[model samples]
Target: MSDSVPMTPECYARLQEELKNRIKVDRPKVVQDIAEARSHGDLSENAEYDAAKDRQAHIEGRIAELNDKLARAEVIDPKSINTDKIVFGATVTLFDTDSDNEVVYQIVGEDEADIKQGKISVTSPVGKALIGHTLDDEVRINVPSGTRIYEVTEIEYK
Candidate 1:
């Protein structure tokens, strides 16, 4: 089963920008590098040619991956989301039960998850458990670190 990728407007824009950069700038550079490497005599002993070929393959793979993701992306504007409960693109503030400290996390797409930035993927254990939950609700998530619980103190769409 394929999962839908819910992306913020900014995330969608970033994906489009990445696709443009790969196709217009990086692809041409790789092709040129490969051509230059090809001019260096025997293909069997040419390290430059092999490296260039490898780089080309990597670039192609990334382009395809980005393209597929963009095609399947479902862009959602945070400002348009309802503010009653936690949802995609909602910024949630929670108090960790174990640590007794406040933590903020923005529920985002899987591709946009960055723990250091406090963006959690919607498919993540905590994010999944938090979805549709209202303020003051306790959420229990089973992570690799075992069971963890957090109290939702606030939910904001902006």
Candidate 2:
């Protein structure tokens, strides 16, 4: 897809580092492994060679994916965003109306989203509903389970 991948500055740096490691460190190591496996015996019955080849393919695919993502990345710095409304990279606290519990989530890129860490992708249901909403705004999100209603309580950049 030609659509840009939106990410925080931190996420952009992390992806760049991973791409470098895959190219400079992992790529060479996989190549050497393949060479060693090929030297062992005939290719028809060499399990090591097959496995190494598979690993090499995986590495190459990942490298290509990383390159494409980096090329289309649109990095946004959370600290530099100045607005009261919810946006990408905003850490938001919401009061769940049904459960009467407060939940915190950080709006982040898809690559950086971790539910356990309270980070949600900007394209997610909750995140989509929270976008452009300000403190005290009531957001209704339609999730897989059912509909969820939440009140915006707090929003932080970092």
Model 1: pairs clashing at backbone N, Cα or C within 3 Å: none
* Candidate 1 lDDT, 1-97, residue by residue in tens: 2555789999999999999999999999989998998898899999999998999999899999898888888899999986798999999999999
Report the lDDT tens digits of candidate 2 across residue range 2-48. 99999998899999999999999999999999999989979999999
Our tally of clashes for model 2 stands at: 0
Candidate models: Cα lDDT each: 0.91, 0.94
For candidate 2, the TM-score is: 0.96
Clashes of each: 0, 0
* Best candidate, lDDT: 2
Candidate 1 regions with alpha-carbon error over 4 angstroms: 1-3
How much is the lDDT of residue 152 in candidate 2?
96
Task: Please state the error at residue 126 of candidate 1 in Å.
Answer: 1.3
The runs of at least 3 residues in candidate 2 whose Cα sits more than 4 Å from the true structure, single-residue gaps closed, are: none
Clashes of 1: 0
